[model samples]
Target: MRTVDFSPLFRSAIGFDRIFDLAEAAQRVGEESYPPYNIERLDENRFQISVALAGFRPDEVDLTVEQNVLTLEGRKGDKEGRTFLHHGISTRSFKRQFTLADHVEVRGARSEDGLLVIDLQREIPEAKKPRRITIGGSSQGNLTQIESEAA
Candidate 1:
């Protein structure tokens, strides 16, 4: 595993500490492909995340969003009495974290056919949306035109 030095990035960038941290964390979380998931862009401002959660019920899974972070957790009950000759499906506990961009919010979540789907949308506030600034004519303050010559 290679370690990346981000000291230079830290020194030059402002308000991008979270992005750098997320990059570092991604490197550390290499090859963690459990409970496979897919991220699909539904539209320009909408997205969907579908995670395969076989043998896990909707009640056993938890989803939360906080501070621009979306977290999904699944906890399954232990099979104490049941014995399987060949177990194919895995019901292991898992947690997944996704970093959301600013103004992005989770719309809803649902489980169907062993797939957990989460919907998200980016909703920019009216105040934040870009507006055409009409550069009107100069102010009407010079109406008198400085009557110094008339004196």
Candidate 2:
């Protein structure tokens, strides 16, 4: 197996230490190329992730959120007594994980039309959101005069 060098990328970035760890974890897990998935930005603060799960029922799949990670697991029971000449469809189990931002939260998840849609919304608290402070003309005027006198 070949090794990937990510030290250069990590060194160039200012404060993305956690991202490097997540990337290493993902590499260790290999790949789950089974079911395809798509992530779409619904709106300014809302997003949706859809995974193509044709043979999976709602109960067969598990969706969970722990800390800042969203994990989706699908497991199908044994299909006995049924014989197929050509098994084209895949009922294989898979687990997919997505790392979310700090303020993002999973609203709900539902399976429909062989697709599992997971909704996410960013809920920034009032204190966390950016606030604009009004600059008073009087304060600016005093600072300007002081600078001019010093100069």
The number of the candidate with the highest lDDT is: 1
In angstroms, the error of model 1 at 53 is 0.3
Segments in model 1 whose C-alpha atoms lie over 4 Å from true places: 15-22, 137-151
Q: Once model 1 is optimally superposed onto the true structure by TM-score, how far is the C-alpha of residue 67 displaced, in angstroms?
A: 0.7
Clashing pairs in 2: none
lDDT per residue for candidate 2 within 29-92, as digits (tens), equals: 6455768999999987899999999988998999999999999998998999989999888999
- Report the lDDT of model 1 for residue 36: 93
* Candidate 1 lDDT trough over 10 residues, lowest sum: 142-151
**Model 2 lDDT, residue 143, Cα:** 20
> lDDT of candidate 2 vs native?
0.82
Query: For every model shown, what is its TM-score relative to the native structure?
Result: 0.81, 0.75
